[model samples]
Target: MAAITYKCPNCDGGLVFDPSSQKYHCEYCLSDFTQEELESLSQELVHRKAEHQEPGLREQERREQDRREQERREPGGAGAQPVLYTCPSCGAQIVTDETTAATFCYYCHNPVVLAGRLEGQFRPDYVIPFQIDRQKAEEIFSQWIGRKKYVPETFYNKKQIESMSGVYFPYWLYSCRVDGELDAQGTRLRTWDTAGMRYTETTVYDVKRQGTMEVDHVARNGLRKANRQLVDSVLPYRMNEKENFSMGYLSGFLAENRDMEKEQFVLDVQTEVRQFALQSLQDQAGSYSSMQVRKKEAGIRDEKWSYALLPVWTLTYNDKARGKIYYFALNGQTGKICGKLPVDRKKIIILFFSVFLPLFLLLMTGGYFLG
Candidate 1:
């Protein structure tokens, strides 16, 4: 596998994508380049890769064969073996799992994108680049943590805060059109007083509604091994801001290739779409005292599926004392946050007594004076 790293044209320093400036920056040279400048450089790198592709192909094939042999030798077929890539800058071995498309080199501390993992069908159709930079994300996290009074201090310490990572999580975006028809019965009641006597009348009517509805950009998590709750809580990404997929956008972040396919979510998405169509038709059934649906039908058409990568900042804290794990995720575009924080039981106990004890003593003293 080829581990590709973007290099600064002037100083040859490793280039990282900067979210705040929307440009690539070289740490050593303090120089920034726009995407246009990097496009030509990328093309040249492709040409160079093509010129020396034969040896890399042979090495990849040999590694695959060895992995297959190893799997066969193990009982019940062991899972996929870790893949190794040589870092372009420092020549250190970068070890990663099958789903890891981009990561950092531990020895050299430079970002590397595994180009082979994201080529061909594995490539994403769209990417929402990180808008909230690391500093902004850390500030947001701190503000959120500061609001919770009983949270443990260890969760937001400097060491733990430094562990936060910006990642591109894979998702499947679904869009479709629905043709729906609804049949229902509605009733209205009328009451009046005439000549000192009460009169009542009830009327029933049949209602029918038919319409076509368009639904777009329903996202579903596409990585199977990820935590579904953590990934899903930071939803509602602005689809309008998405840009065409480019490997350069992933330079300074961690990214994962999707193992799950769109087919896995088709049934669930279709059911949700149908329910929404039916409910919408019912809502238009007009004003009535009571309405009951007699028949409803919906047909989904023109289904569309898009593979995309969305940005998130994630942190994990393990509360070993309680044997529990807490997760924190922030939306990289909107700065929305979702987290599970460790509560300090001692603080809660103190707060409980501090407020109620004073009130209790005042009540007792007043009762004694009245007696």
Candidate 2:
């Protein structure tokens, strides 16, 4: 469950983080509070879990208490019955996922970040703030669809365009130094002609090279329910710009803890770094006409892992006419957009026949005249 929503000290209104201002804002009273101030006011709520445990407990009881606390600290999808917390301003019960870090109240539109959701192991190490605000996202979405010709006009309705939100997707960034060697057989062809007889010979040579490479951030998105393909299409965040994690940054925006473990993706990270090392070695063998890799050896000398939140603007359009859904995603930091676009079948067929029929008739008439 979320710790609780922060209440405005001046007007008793629910406070929300504003991405534009990068501070908690109260529309009711026009008051602004820094995240530090809010944290100070709600520091006691972080220990609310301890308030429920019994003062004196047996060994098994203490272990059970510890396990329960660990479960609360971890991120997961709660059952359909979401844990509900009452909005401090409106007393409205706010339903949320078990792992959600921040959300806004539906009744009062008060944006609140769950202070406890970002505590301990659940905390992110770095965060890339939303560089592209929602207003810019709307314009980018408009320009993107305007360039796509075959999309049904209904797909760009005002409602569909306005539904986008800035979400910080969870990711694990792995950095490591890799040193490896690659072995390959490279072939170069030699041809010669003498006394009207041609002879061709192919020379095969053993090739090997050693190199070192550093991978700063190999990112893996964390939400299990999010479409991996769609999420990955907007990749390659600028790790150089990431800031140390702060719950204050999450106030106005949506953020979440990772649902997947880093161990689950360790092999994938290893494969990526190894592939880079091997490819670098192969690039050195450019003189060969063709090469086949024979052996590979790679190892990570040092490994570092960081939990981060990367920004993404996503929109999914359900095309009712074709009974298919099209997803459009943009990198909130880079403004990169990618998705599948549906083509108009009827228009394609008409254009094909219209252009082909004239050419076919002209060829037939010219043949008859020549005959």
Candidate 3:
């Protein structure tokens, strides 16, 4: 596997994608390049990589091959293996699991994209790049934390704030057309008083509705290892704003490859679509005093599936004493936020006592004066 990094042509420093400016920036020399300029440079690097091979990289590949061979010889030894790649900037070994498609080198802090992991079928068709930058995300997090009274201080400290990361999560987008019909019975009641007597009438009518609906961009998480609730709560990225997938967008962010396939979600998505269509037809049955649905039929066709990468800003805190993990996530495009924060029990107990103690003293003094 080959690890790739974008280097600034002017200063030869590591380049990272800047969400605020939508450009590649070199932090060392403060230089920025547009996508067109970087495309040419990347092509040149590709040619150079094909021609030259580093000795350290060759050694790492040899070791990996040996490890695989040994695993094959041993029974019940085949399992997930770590991959190793040499960082071009620092010449240090970068270790990653099979699912990590993009990450930062621990030694040099330069972003590295594992090209092999994103090749062929694993490549995403569309990507929603991070619209909320690190600074904006941090500001939003600070404001949210400030509103809470009993949250622990350690959860929003400087170190924890810096640990927040921008990640591109894999999702499967589904679109389809549904043809549906619904049959129902509706009833209306009429009551009146005439000549000092009560009269009542009930009328019943048969209702039928038919329509076609086109549903688009129903997204489902594609990585099985990801926390479904944490990611799903921050939804709804602007699908209309999604751009064509470009490796450049993955430069500064961590990205994961999909472990779950579209086939896995096929039945669920189809059922959801059918239910939605039936509900729409039912709603069109008009306003009646009472209604009962008799039959509903829906047929789905022209199904389309596309793999996409959506952006999110995430922070996690592990409460080791409590054996629990808390998460904070924000939608990268819409600025929607969701979090599970840890409350400080000590702070709550102190607050409870302080308020009641003052009230209790006031009550006792008032009673003494009355007596």
lDDT of model 2 at residue 341?
73
The digit string of per-residue lDDT tens for model 3 on 1-371 reads: 56888888988888888989888999999999988898898888878965797879868876765664455336456525676789978989998875788999999999998876676677899999888899999999999999999989999999999999999999999998999999899998899999999998999999999988999999999988899998889988889999888888899899998878899999999998898899888888888899988988999989999999999999999999899999999998899999999999999889878998788889999999999
| lDDT of candidate 2 over 273-339, digit per residue (tens) | 8888887778876788789888888889789989999888888888677788888889988988888
Specify the highest-TM-score model's number.
1
Worst 10 residues of 2 by lDDT: 72-81
Question: Which 10-residue span in candidate 1 carries the lowest summed lDDT?
Answer: 70-79
Q: What's every prediction's RMSD, in angstroms?
A: 3.1, 5.1, 4.0
Question: Backbone clashes in each candidate structure, one number apiece?
Answer: 0, 1, 0
* Model 1 lDDT per residue over 189-289, tens place: 89999999999899999999999999988999998889888989999899999998988899999999887889999999999999999998888888888
Q: TM-scores across all candidates? A: 0.90, 0.78, 0.89
Q: Candidate 1, 224: how far from true, in Å?
A: 1.9
Scored by Cα lDDT, where does model 1 land?
0.89
The runs of at least 3 residues in candidate 3 whose Cα sits more than 4 Å from the true structure, single-residue gaps closed, are: 47-79, 192-198, 360-371
